[model samples]
Each structure stands twice: as C-alpha cells, then as structure tokens.
Target: MNPRLLLAIYLAITLAPLGLSAFSGRPARSLWDELASGAGMLAYAIILAEFLLSGRFRSISRRIGMDVTMRFHQLFARSALVFALLHPFLYRAPSKPPYPWDTTRQLTLTDDLSAIASGVAAWLLLTPLVLQAIGRDRLDMRYEVWRLMHGLGAAAVAALLLHHTLAAGRYSADPVLAAVWIGLFAIALASLLSIYLVKPVLKRMRPWVVDSVRPVAARTWEVTLAPRGHGGLRYLAGQFAWLNIGHGPASLFENPFSISSAPAAGNRVAFIIKELGDFTRTVGRIRPGTPAYLDAPHGHLCVAGRDEPGIALIAGGVGIAPLLGILRQLRLDRDPRPTLLAYGNRVAEQIVCRDEIDDLARHHGTRVIHALQEPPPGWTGHSGMLDAAFFRDHLADPGMREWLFVICGPPAMMDAAETALIGLGVPARQIICERFRYD
Candidate 1:
C-alpha cells in the first residue's frame, strides 16, 4: 500500500486503546488523572507498535522504503518516551488505596505496590534505551552487542508496561482493553522471535558460499556469494541485503550492503563494500568458500515498473553499488529508455569499475558524466562536487524533468541532488532515493 494508507493503519492501531478507554463507561476522574492514563496508554501502544517497525518486515518497508520506515521508528520512539516520562507527573489524584465505597477507584489512584514498581522500572529503562539509540555511534560498543542489548531492553520494558497497565490502569479492568493490551504485547514478542529466532533457522537451510573477494577501488572490495543449494535470491535491481559471511546465521555480525550484481547475471550475488570500520574492515580477508547468509532485497530503490522515457542515475563514491545493479539490469534487458549516469568520487582512484562504466557509454549509448573533487593533471571530467550547480549545468533539459531519477551517495550529496531535481521541476514521485543512515 501507499505511505498514506500505511500511516492511516498505523494511526488506527496506536490510537485504538485510547479510543476504547474513552468510551468504556467508567466514571470519569479528574482531568489530570485522565490525561495521565491517556499518556500511559498511548505510550504503551506506540512502544508495542515499534516492534513491527524494526525494518525487518518487508510488507511494511517495501512501499515506504526501509530508510523511511526506520525514520518513523526512531521518531515514534522519541514521542513515546516523552509520553511515558510525563505520565506520572500528570496525575492529580492521590496515590492511595481505593476507599471501600469508591470501588471504581475514581477518587484515588491504584496503590498496588508491585504495579507501581513495574511502571517505575519501565519508566527508568526507557530513557536509557532511547539515549543509547540516539547516541549509538558515539558509544564504544560493537554493533552486535548493542543490537542484543537493545532487543532485550525493549522486551523488558514492554513486559513491565503490560503488567503495570493491567494491574494499575482504571480502564484496563474492562475485559476488552485487557485483551487488547495482551494481544499487542504478544504480537510484539512474536515479532522479536521472528527476527532473532525464526529467520536465522531459515537462513541456515538455504545458505550461500563465498565465491570471490577482491579489491575493486580505493578501500573498496567486491564480494560475491553463490547459493549452495537452492535458487539464489530473487530481488529487483537497486536493492540491498544484510550480509553475514563466515558466521553462523544466529550471529549478529551481519551488515547491510547493496547488490552490485544485476539480477539477470545468474544466481551469484555481488556486493560493493567500502571499508570504514567494524565488520567492513575485514572484507578483504574473507576467503572463497566461506559460508554466507543474506536477509535481502529490503529497499524500494528499484525502477521495475516505472514508465519514464529515460532513467537518470546519480552516485557518489561506493554508493554506486545499487545504481550499478540498475545500470547492468537495464543493459541486460536491452531497455530502450535513454540512460544517464552522473557518478562522482573524491579522487580518480576511488572511481570503481571504470572500464565497465566507460563501456556503457561507448557501446550502449548512455550519457556518462564523471565528477572528481581532486582531479589528476589533464583530467577531462568535471572537477568539482556534484552539487546543485553540477546538476543544473548537465541536467537542465526539460525532457529530463520527466525522466525517473535514482540517487544513492553521501548523505549531503543525495540531499543536494534531490533538492536540485525538484528545483529543476522533476516531480517528487519520479525521484527515488534511500539513505543508509536514518540520523
């Protein structure tokens, strides 16, 4: 479904509890007390819904793009945190046992100690959980370790919130709301199990073996994997996967990388990896025949059904991985749409697959423009960043405005390219882009 429909569904799910509680026929409490309950219920709903937004479910991410899905996950998490933090402070009712005559507890908040403790624990844990996510890159921890901690921590908070809500919440005494809370909590836990348990088991059954690992450009390596038994991954071009090589399926060592190989190029898949740190730094040492696993085809960067008269590809540095797959697929299909590639790098040596790129322009009638920040002596390509000026100078044709534009690169460059395309009159629908980082 489209993003608007997805968003509507999300709103319906998250607001269901509040809507139910509002109409549950319970005697109304003080305004502050009602706001407190509403805040707590809304926060819990958003938190549970977060489980499904973890960027693993293809059904949710396929239409919105994984990056956009993740962006939603992060933003909703912060909003939930705010509501949770304010829940306690918003209450105006006294924290005491319900009077014998006040059986409904409308005059006093629930005084159940265990329920109160659970709420406080969840409240405390949530702050650190959100902080760690926000400052993930600044922390001195392995990504794998962080992932495990995050999953366990979130599960703990969810459990605590469920117990606190069922025991202390006024509206939750109603059977329907209680069931809703339990159902949501169960779905959250099930989502965790599917990601951390079920998917690994499936990966083990259909494994891949390393076919080759070789340096392709400055600090970049091209790694290929061939299916050991089953048919290889069937994915559209310009998509990515979480790759785990020389590690068990259960391990958290997997890192996401784009497929540089065309889907039409047999079953073996290729990744263009630029080493920055962590798992990537060891890409060059991976040997042939090592075991590999893929959780793949996760991005909405493909142009499969687009009917634009032409295709424009923009890339910066190793970000060209997915774009290269698009270019190769187009060539293999003998697509008649005119193509343009504007690839940029910091230096000449950083340019990858130079010969193949040249061949596309020389033999396939593609318009290829290369840009370099620091050019060598007598360099003929454009000698500057691929900024607004570069796009304006090379891509101002009115016909180009109607063409489909796909861009992947450094965050800044991608933003500039997107803005420039819009400034040049390209419809937002015709431009496809995905960021590797949500922040």
Candidate 2:
C-alpha cells in the first residue's frame, strides 16, 4: 500500500473513538468510550515516543509530518494541557450538598490545585518550544545548554503528567486505557534511559578507536573511525549516525553526522565535518586512536526504492553531504539511470566534493551543473542562483515530469527550488526534499 494512504488509515483507526464521541448523546460509559479514551492516550504516548527517540528536532518534525516539529509540538502540548485541565471539571462527582451549584463550586475550587501544577509543567515545556520556534536565530544558547534545558523541561512535564494521570484515575479505570497510557510512558522512559544510561554503559564496555583524522578543507576535516575489535555499523547511503568522542557516554556531547562514504564498504566510516561552531571546531584536534561510540544508520533519505527514469539533485552548501552518499551508492549499485546535479555554492572555492562530482559525471554518465553565486574573473561555469530559467534551460524534457527531483539545501533554497519546480509544472508527488533545519 502507498505509505501516505497507510498513514491515513492508521490515523483514522487511532482517532475513530473521539470522532464517534461527538455523536453520542450519553456520557461516556460503554466499552466504546473506554476504547476511545484508550486510543487517545496511546496517541499521546506515540507523540512522546517519537520525540524522545529522535536524535534531532528536524528528524522528529519530519516523522510527525511538519516543516518545523517544535511548532507542532508546542501547539499539541498546549492542546493536551487544555484537555487535561477540562477533563476533571467535566467528569467530577457531585458533593454532599447534592446541589448542582455546590458541585460546580467544589470542582472549581479543587481543580485549580491540580490544574496549576500541570499548567506550570506544560508552560515550562511550551516556553522553550515557542522560544526556539520564534527566536532560533536570536536566542544564541549553546547547543549543549539548549539540549539540557529541553531534556530537563520534558522530564518535568512527564512527571507532572504522570501525577495528573494517577490523581484522576477514572480514565485509568478501564484496563485498556490504563494499559495504553502506562505502555506509552514505559516506552518513552525506556527509550530515554537506554540512550542516557544503557547505551553509555555499553559504549564504555566496548568502544571504537578513531583510526585517523585528515583535514579536508580550511574548516572541514574527514574523521576516519574503525571498530576496535568488532566490525562497525552497516549503514545505507544518505543515512546519519550519532557520534560521541569521549571515554564514557556521560560526556553529554553527541551529535549526528551523515556518512560520506558508500555503504558497500564496511568496518570503517568517514564523516566530513565542517567547523560551524564550537563542537565541530574541536573535532579535528581530537587525538588519533581516541575511543568513539557511534549509534547510527538512521534517516529515510535514500534512492534505493525510487524507480524514476531520471533524477535531478538540487543541493546548496553542506546540504550536498547526503547527496554525495546517494551518488556513491548509485555508482556502487551500478545503476545507470540518468542523473543531473545542480550544485550551488556562494563561490567557486566553496564548492565541496568538486573533483568527485566531476569524476562522477565523466565515469557514470551523470551531468553536473555548478551554479556559483559569485564567480571569480576566470570562472567559466554557470553563474547566478538556480531559478525557473535554469531548470527550463537544462532539463532534457521539462514537460515529461518523469524525473524525480531530489532537493537538499538551506530552507530558503529548498523552498525556492520547490516553488520553481512547481511553477515549471512538476507534480508535487514527483518532487522529494529533505529539511535539515533543527530549530
């Protein structure tokens, strides 16, 4: 079945109970109500699971089908807070006075205590999410600081949510609902604990030795790692792995980087690191043979299942990292489908993997179009940004729409390329892009 259709079906199944509630005249009492409540709990649990398991915000956002996952997270979290607040008010029992006014007064008076605690927790979680969404550029918190705050705030919310759930156990009275809620909590806790504790313990027990580190460019370096004794992870092209360059997992500094090599080659992996900030700037200086731990082979950006007759890759800056992996995989797989790459860089000197790209064009029948924003005096390649005119001129058959356009770039560049492709009559389904922005 089509993945989108399957997702739709799954969502419908998960939300069917809530949909039926609007039509039901009586208050929730039957098995159907229990089922609906159970499903809702399960959905919330799934959301938490997806968030905690993700290595980065971008990955979580994509998993949840949003351009910015944090925005959706804030919206959903606030909505959950509202639902949680109203839950008791709508279902509380009457007081001894037996008067409706008395019951209302009693609920209003006591609800604030539980509501305030959960509200505070929800606000703590929502504040960072909203700030990150709106002030990503302005709030210059270090990555480590931001990560610590995010994790701690999430834990606070989870603990408060647990308290709220247990305090009002009506929802948990139904075994199915209780089980789903507890199961979700357990999964999220276990996933986080595994990442924070178990994985680190194992890494300490067995670690990989960094074989060598070679400077590739002014600020970029290529780090080659080999498993100490056991073979390393088996990964596909366009997939990323998390790296921790320390003795124990307690270091609290782990980042995801794409594997710049073909997957067919085993036991060793190469990561092309560019020093954009503090974490990466020190990468090259790490001593050779230092112990490193990697948790890897993640990401859905690959051309393995794509059967399009032609492929067009649009890349900008370091976004070309994954595309390099894809190209290498295509070569290793011996797939000769016509591939066109429109790689854009600010200047000629910044064009990464220039030699490899040119070599691919020469040997694999691929065509590479280099778009330089500011060409030097002696430059002869295409100049200016990639727009509608560029696509109209270079694409072999613009009207065919049989080509798969794979775009990876800065958010603005990706948006522009997508719009230009759409304006040129490419169907939405035929265009594929990856968003790597974390904030």
Candidate 3:
C-alpha cells in the first residue's frame, strides 16, 4: 500500500469520531456528541504524540516525502492557540452579579482571578507562537531564542490546557476519554522531561572527550570527538549529530552538525562546524581532550536505498558537509554511479574541502563545477551566482527530469536553484532539498 494511503487511514481512525459528530442531530449529552468530543480529544492526543515521539515523527515525515513535519508543527501550534482561545469562552459561564468588594463580581470556572491569570498566560504563549511562525525572520530572533521560546510556549499551553480540561469537567465526565487525555499529557510531559532533564544528567556521567579542532577555513572548523569509553554513536554517512561543548550532558546548547567523516573511517566522529552562533564561534577555543557530549546520527540525507541512474549535488557553504559525507561513502563503497557536484561559494578561498572534492571527482569519474560569486584575478572557474542560465548551459538534456537533484544551501540559494529547476519544467518530485537552519 502507498505510505500516504496508510497515513490517511490512520488519520481517519483517529479523527472519524469528530466527523461523525458533525453529522449527528442530537444534543451535547447524546452518544454521538460524546463520541465526537472523545475523537476530538484523540486528535489532540495524536498531535501531542507527534511532538513527543521524535523517531516516529522523523519516519513519517520522511515517508511522506515532503517537509510535512515542520508544516504539521506549525499547524498544530496554530490549532492549539485557537483551542486556547475557545476553551476559556466555552468552559467559563457568564459572570454573575454579586454584592462583593467592588463593582461587578465576575464568576469564573475557577476563581475569576485564577481564570484571568491562566488566560493571560495562555495568551502570552500562543501570541508568540503565532508571531514566530508568521514573522520569524522579521523578529531577528536567533535560532536559540526561537527554540527556547517554543519550549516555554509549549509548557505554558500544556499547563493552561490541563487547567481547562480539569475545570470544564465535561470531557472528564467520560472516564475513557479522561484517561486517554491524562495518558497523552503524561507521555508528552515525560518525553520533554527526558529530553531536557534526564538526557543531560546522563551526559554529565558519560561525557565524550574532544580530541582535536582543525580549521577547514576561517569560518569553518572540524571538531573531532572520542567517547570516554565505547566512543560516541556509530552513524552512517550523510547523518548529523548535535554537539554540546561547554554545557552539561543534557544542556540544550547543543547544535546539529553533519558528520564530515565517513562511518567506515573508524570510531572517532568529526563534525564540520560553521560559525553560526555563540556556541559554534567558541568551538575553536576549547582545548583538545575537553569533555563534551553528543546527540547524534539524525537526519534522512542518505542514499542507502536510492536507485537513481545519476545523482546531482548542489551545495552552498557549510551545506556541503552532508554532501561530503555522501561522497566519502560512495568512494569507500566503490560505487560507479555517475555523480555531479555544483558547489557555490562566496569566494574561491571559502570553498571548503576543495582538494578532497577534486580527488573524489578524479577517482570516481564525477564532475565538479565550482560556482563562485567573487573569483580572484587569476581564477579561471565559473563566476557569478548559480541561476537558470547556469543550469541551462551546464545541465544535459534540458527536458529530462529523471535524474535526482539533491540541494542543500542557504535559504536564498536553495530558493534560486529550486526556482530555476521548476522554471526549466522539472517535476517537483524530482527535486529533493534539505534546509540546514538550526531551528
């Protein structure tokens, strides 16, 4: 069966109750209404599960073959905000006039003051989530800030949601639905606690030692790590690992870095780090053998099971890290499939792993095309940014869309390349891209 078909079936099973309720012509106390309400709770539970289960989320997103995970995250957050707004209005009865201390004594689900406080908290959380999703770039908020805010917002929403669930008493009136809601909340809480608390504690106990830091360029550094005992995680090529240098084992300061070295190279793992933030900028400052922790081997950028006749890699800056790993894997595996690399850099000097790329091209019969914005006086390679004209000139058979195109780069470059390909009549399914933003 098609993976998408299975996903549709799963969604129907989880949300059919709500659909059934919409068609029922009965009061709130009727069985159909109760079933619909229960199904609504179940749908929310599924959303919560999606946020908690990292493995399942990754698998499903990869299977769907789109950036559905991120889209779902945005959708779930927006829906939660809407629910937060509706929960207060629906659950709380209108204020009753009473001769209290002041003008009009407003009655609430909980005490009026407590209800107001929780509502304010929920608003504070939901507002930022909506703003961040809509205007993330305009806010100039750093990736770390965004991540921290997302976590805080999720916690606040969960707390307010729990308060509403308990105070309303309608959903809780149904024992099974209440139990399912509680179970879902418990799982979300536990998963978050494990990631934030337990994981760091474990890392403090078993920290990997940083062996060396080598400069690949002025802005890029390769940090090597050796596990204290059994070594860090064993990962395939084209995978990424999060590195926490100065923080404790469970610290959220970790940043994802692609494994620059191939897995076949041995026990030590190396990450090619670009100076993108405070954590990455200080990477070169840490002395060799300093204790560190890694959470790794994530991402689905591998070509393990792919059977394409040819592969084309388009990379910009540090986005080349995963492509490098893929190339190294191909070299080690001795695969003779034709490959082409179109690497873009600001200047000739900023081109990373140039020698290694050239060597791979020579050995594996791959073609390397260097596209630079500013080539030096003596430079002879292609100049200017990669655009439609560039692809039109270099790519063979302008109409054929069968070849796989793997793109990884800065947002603008990736957008340009994607636009160029689509303008040339390339099918959307034929183009695969990986956005490398940390958040």
- The 10 consecutive residues of candidate 2 with the worst lDDT sum are 103-112
lDDT of 3 at 227: 80
Ranking of models by TM-score: 1, 3, 2
Residue lDDT tens for model 3, 1-439: 3566646754664464344434444335434434433533543544455454332234454454324455555665566556544444444234433336532222312355664566456556666667675677677767668777767667667667555554443435345555655766777777677677777776776678888988886688888888888655767677777678866775567776778788877778888888877678677787897888876656666776777777788888888888888888888888778888898888877888788888888888778999889888977778887777778767646534666787777878888888887777777777777654424
Which pairs in model 1 have colliding backbones?
A: none
Model 1 collision count: 0
In candidate 3, position 125 carries an lDDT of 68
What is candidate 3's TM-score against the reference?
Answer: 0.81
The global Cα lDDT (0 to 1) of model 3 is: 0.67
Q: How far does residue 97 in candidate 2 sit from its true spot (Å)?
A: 9.0
lDDT per model vs. reference = 0.94, 0.65, 0.67
Off by over 4 Å in 3: 1-26, 29-50, 53-68, 86-120, 132-146, 201-206, 398-400, 422-427
Each prediction's TM-score against the native?
0.99, 0.78, 0.81
Q: Candidate 2 at 55: error in angstroms?
A: 6.7
Off by over 4 Å in 2: 1-137, 169-179, 201-206
> Per-residue alpha-carbon lDDT of model 2 for 124-204, expressed as tens digits?
564455456446457777776777776666666665665555444334434555455566567667766776777778776
